[model samples]
Target: ADMPGISKDRLNVKVEGDTLTIEGDAEIPMPEGMEPLYADVRATHYQRSFTLSSEMDTEKVEASLKHGVLTLHIPKREEHKPRKIEVQVD
Candidate 1:
């Protein structure tokens, strides 16, 4: 979810079964007449994945990108959420 300086056009997300995958690539263009001898920034490509649990509601999962930051939301299903069981004594 910490996808800073990444654009939506360069981002790819996929979920299969219980696995979630995220991939992206970024390349900054340089001027033809200007070149830096010492540069710490360069083109980058990344891939990450995580195994989701059965409690996650994959159908309702959502994602949003803002200010180069990506956020993913995976809420627990109603049936999977913790609930207080009622006590009845006969």
Candidate 2:
């Protein structure tokens, strides 16, 4: 399903260890000629949680949003990522 009203920019996310938290607000527009309907459709705050894999490095996690588009870049830990090492033997 496509959530046209809900885009990436309208949200904020934070990740910790194997868990990720998503928080954001959504705006709802009122229809025309709906004066009789008494309702409060303001942007409501929301939160969600998710479990991540062990390969993720919570310390290097980064996120940014522009023009209603959100982007998150999670870099791996130095020790966990591939690196060249020298072999020392006696």
Candidate 3:
């Protein structure tokens, strides 16, 4: 079952050694009520975070949120970037 509220592609991750940091937020409307409920909606802010992989590159990470959707683009370092190496023998 998929409960759709907000979705993030990468969530903007940065890996520093063994520490990974993720920062983002979501904007949800308060319940429809004329009067104050149990609690005010002012404190209904949204935020989320996560710990990333140790191999992630922190310097090339990017994140953005628009229209309630979040996008994260994490680019690894050249050394960490995935590629095939060819060897030549003469």
Candidate 4:
């Protein structure tokens, strides 16, 4: 996710059952000792939700935010992973 201007401290990520939620607050700070006469950008709240599949391992999900980009790594369950079987010569 491209979340420019949002700090990591103001971001929240949570997973409940099959639901995954992401919330954050975006605020434009004013320069010190300067008052804004008119501001085009203002503070805003952002939220997004997603439903995870059973094949995904929720417990092993990983999240990281850097350079205003949020990244999520969701790995497949053990049973869902591809397996190789070798056949024995009868």
Candidate 5:
């Protein structure tokens, strides 16, 4: 789940030593006229971490943000990808 007003600039994604971290912050604007009686929101900061193995190609990663949504693409290495293996029988 993600907040409505989060942008790409506020997000930080990085991968290091088999660890992937995704973090960001959201700003909440104070409503005009009337103040909130109680405010308890996770909109201030967000963080997520993932453990990656050797199969993940960390060097070649892609990320895109559209309409306040973040998308990340992590592709597998050529050796890790699915391929055909031939067997010889004599």
Candidate 6:
């Protein structure tokens, strides 16, 4: 996710059952001793939810945030991974 201007500490990721939820707050702070008289940008709250497939392993999900970008890695279940099949010729 391209979440520019959002701090990692202000982000939250959670998975429950088949639902995945992401929540965060975005705020722009003003300089010390400076007050905003006519500001166009305001604080914002963001939340997104997704339904995970049965083949996805929620227990092994990994999340990382760097340079204002959020990344999620979800591996498929062991049984759902592709396997090579051997052919026997008689």
Clash totals for all candidate models: 0, 0, 0, 0, 0, 0
Which 10-residue span in candidate 6 carries the lowest summed lDDT?
38-47
TM-score of predicted structure 3:
0.48
Distance from true location, Cα of 36 in model 1, Å: 3.7
Q: Score every model by TM-score.
A: 0.79, 0.56, 0.48, 0.85, 0.76, 0.85
Off by over 4 Å in 6: 36-43
For each candidate in the order shown, give its overall lDDT on alpha carbons: 0.83, 0.67, 0.53, 0.89, 0.80, 0.88
Clash pairs, model 5 backbone: none
Whose TM-score is higher: candidate 1's or candidate 6's? 6
**Model 1 TM-score (2 dp):** 0.79
Q: Model 5: how far is 22 from its true place, Å?
A: 0.6
Worst 10 residues of 1 by lDDT: 37-46
lDDT of 6 by residue, 30-84 (tens): 7999987986545467789999999999999999999878999999999999999
Weakest 10 consecutive residues of candidate 3 by summed lDDT: 1-10
Q: Which wins on lDDT, candidate 1 or candidate 2?
A: 1
For residue 74, give model 4's deviation from the true position in Å.
0.7
How much does each candidate deviate from the true structure in C-alpha RMSD? 2.2, 5.9, 6.6, 2.2, 2.8, 2.0
Off by over 4 Å in 5: 1-3, 31-34, 37-40, 86-90
For residues 54-81, write the lDDT of model 3, one tens digit per residue.
5666677776656555567766567766
- Number of clashing residue pairs, candidate 1: 0
* Order by lDDT, highest first: 4, 6, 1, 5, 2, 3
lDDT of 5 by residue, 16-76 (tens): 9899888888866786887877876745788889998799899997888777677889999
The ten-residue window of minimal lDDT in model 4 covers 36-45
lDDT of 3 at 58: 64
**Comparison by lDDT, 1 against 6, better one:** 6
